[model samples]
Target chain A: MKAVEFQGLEVQYGDMPALRDASGSFETAAMTAIVGPNGAGKSTLLKAALGLIPSTGRVAFFGKPLAEMRARVAYVPQRASVDWDFPVRVIDVVVQGLYRELGLLGRLRLSHRRRALDCLERVGMADYASRQIGALSGGQQQRVFLARALAQNADLYLLDEPFAGVDAATESAIIAVLKSLRDQGRSVVAVHHDLATVPAYFDRVLLLNRHVQAEGPVAETFTPEALARLYGGLLPQLS
Target chain B: MSALDFLAFSAPPMLIALLAALACALPGNFLLLRRQALLGDAISHVVLPGIVLGFLLTGGASTPAMMAGAALAALAAAALIELLQRSARLDPGVAMGATFTAMFALGVLALELSGAGAVHLDVEHALYGNLESLIWFDATDWSALITPATLATLPPELFRMAATLALLAALCWLFWRPLVILTFDEGFARSLGLPVRLLSAGIVAAATLAAVAAFAAVGSILTIAMLICPPAAARLCTHRLGPQVALSLVFAAASALIGYVLGGYGPLWLGLPASVSAAGMIATTSGLILATAALWHKR
Candidate 1:
């Protein structure tokens, strides 16, 4: 099933076009990596997909509009974009993921707290639940964000640059978690920067540079020619 | 002085000041968390012109009339700042500085042109306030306190501060979760389908109300001080939002009490003849508390 579909999407910052006439679809139970050079609108495409930015487009989830199915979607923005020095505990951030279910005045039940702790355990951050978020390292912060997304229990997860500055062990752990989500028949779309790990980590790749350059299974679409076209000829040899 | 005389003379002003401090501190935490402390400063400045306009139109400094004018002026100032930032693409600080200074200057000019100098509508009163003057002098006897006439004789500023505090407390209680979520992570809050726009606007309005309500007693400078300092001090004390808010309220109340006592009596203790400006003293106390908290945290 098509978990998310974008048609004729366009986003502009001032006079410059960030994503122009972009269109694509992601199926359920697949790990899709959006790969591109810097300024390639990879983040912009994800934001526009969720209508976080002003964009002219039609975004549907499972044949329904995004607004109607917003509760079923989880988004983890780039760690670099947030203020790490903010005064909040690790558990506080994880609880924010349940805000939708908690609503404005809903109390946090013991069951909800247990679920959040379980999500933290899944991301290996249970020990740091009481620590301030700013005290964590780069990789630990990324894992905390993943724990937040995990607590949402959404059917579709959209992550932006989750592996931008993590250690090798943390990277593999994150990949393992994503693969588990895929195995559970959930869609996981990530804005990925490391090209070397594309085929190894992702089942599908969407090459982007202000638009969808090439998109399909890793073996078919992530070709040297397509990557060269997307990266403006600064292509690396890939297996 | 006897205990009754002390209660009659000092307690009213102290309570009023404490309530005013709390009113500003509650919403101040969210403003500080959102990194919009300057917005609170801007609202305080812009509301001056509204107060002057309200005085001119009504020929009396009624709370409702002044509050209405101040609310309108605050909204305009906020809108102007936003417009300047978006349309002219100016920096937020520059936009806020421009709009607030112009409005404050207009307020000063209006005070001058309207011949309100003979009244209590001067720049000194607008900025420094007259906290010392809000005395409950109508209670001639201790029995009058329990009588219905005591209600009629209570200082109007006291009622205004109490009402404002109550409203602010209710708002904070009702919207605590959404406000905390939005302040911590706005993008996640938006993705959760929360009414981000409405929540932002509500916070802005609440801040404006606080500034205006505290204007008559604490003035704009003290309002800004109370709004930013206590929260900052609280931030230094705790890493959690709930604890931070509770600590801020405690800090605010402490500032108000200490400031009032020091301003009213510390000069006599120092062998001086006169008291000091209670509002100014309160602002200074809040700043001192914040500095102490920072130092203590570093230790």
Candidate 2:
């Protein structure tokens, strides 16, 4: 069974095609890593699939439309996508994840606060809940974002570059969390940048370069030749 | 500065400025945080054309007509900015700058082309406004605070400003959560099924409402000043969004009070014969406060 699937998806930015007829699917209850070269429309693919940006074609989750499953899906965008300098506390951001349950004007209660703290605790960031988001290091900020995604209590998680610029400890902690979520039968999809860690961290791999080059189990698909073809031989390590 | 004299000659304009400053400052928090602070300046500028056009069409500056016109023009300017940013691939600041300058020039041209310039629609009025003349003659003393007839004689602007402030505050409180989330991370907000586009448009709409209403009570100068200055300064004073917003309002009220008093009576205290433009003074005071915040943040 597929967790999420897209067919013939296309995105154009001012006459330039960022994504071109991309068709792919990730299996249910598994971890998939979307690996691509720079400007390969990796982030654009996630944005388009989630309806965060304008794109042609449709995406479905669990054989149902996104609207029907929105409550069950959580997304953690790239940490650099937002202005970290924004005056928001770590707890406030985590609390935002509960906005759907909180309703439009629902006040945060003690229970809500406890739940948010629990999410922070899972990320090992409970102590920094009151600290400003901007003051945290890159890895810590990324973990805080993951905590926010966790607070949603969703069945599927979409993460964009979750490990980029993070420290080794943070990277291991994040992978452990993702693996735990997968072990619990939830699906995890991340736009991963590190070529060396693909097989070690992800069970499935999708090599995308404006379109899907190859996609299947990481053992069968994430190879030097596949990456060489996807990156047009630009990646020195692949050589 | 007798009680009666102050009530009759000064209270209305001062109160109007305060209310207008507060209203504009509230939305300014979101704008500054989202790096769209100049949108306030743009909306304030575009409202001039709307006001002039409304007056030209209606033959008088009716409050409803002026507000509606300003709102329409602000929406148009915002649309143009978005179009330029999306289609033309322009930076947000550059798009806002281009759109607002053209709209403001259109307003000036409309004022000149029409015979409205001879009336109250002059550029000077658009900038400095008739704040000094918004006095309450019937409110001669403290009794005027409660007397129905005396209160009825208060400047219409005072009521308009108060109503505008209340409406903006209520709307902010109602949509406070979505507003903060969207301002912080638009993509995450979208993933949450938060109607990201509508919330974004709502923010611009609220800003237009605040800018147009404030533009009516004070001039565009004070409207822009209070919108960006207070929020920008408040951002430096606090790292928390709620506290920053509260501090922005405090800065706004302080600027209004200090600037109004200094503009109105500082000349008298200095033994000068006349006073300065309250709108300009208010803008200056806001800038000073922003500078102070920057320095304090440095510490």
Tell me the whole-model lDDT of each prediction, alpha carbons only.
0.88, 0.89
Candidate 1: list runs displaced more than 4 Å.
A236-239, B59-63, B83-90, B112-118
For model 2, the stretches where C-alpha displacement exceeds 4 angstroms are A233-239, B61-63, B141-143
* Model no. 2, DockQ: 0.88
Docking class of 1: medium
Candidate 1 residue lDDT tens string, A1-239? 69898888999888899998998888789999999988989999988888777899888988898889988999998988788878889998999889888877898999999999999998888999999999999999999999999999999999999998998888988999999999999999999988888989999999889888778999999888888888889886664
- Proportion of native contacts in model 1? 0.73
Question: Candidate 1, A208: how far from true, in Å?
Answer: 1.5
Q: What is the model-wide C-alpha lDDT for candidate 2?
A: 0.89
Compared with the true structure, what per-residue lDDT tens digits does model 2 show for residues A1-239? 78999999999987889999999998888999999988999999999999998999879988899999998899999999998888889999999889889988787899999999999998899999999999999999999999999999998999999998999999998999999999999999999988888888999999898998888998889877887788887865731
- Please, what are the lDDT tens digits per residue for candidate 2 over residues B1-299? 68788888888899999999999999998888878899998997888788888988899967788778898999999888878987888999999999999999998899888877888676676677678889998875688889998899899888888998899899899989989999989899899888877888888887888888888778889998999999999989988888988999999999999999999878889999999999888889999999999998899
Best by DockQ: 2
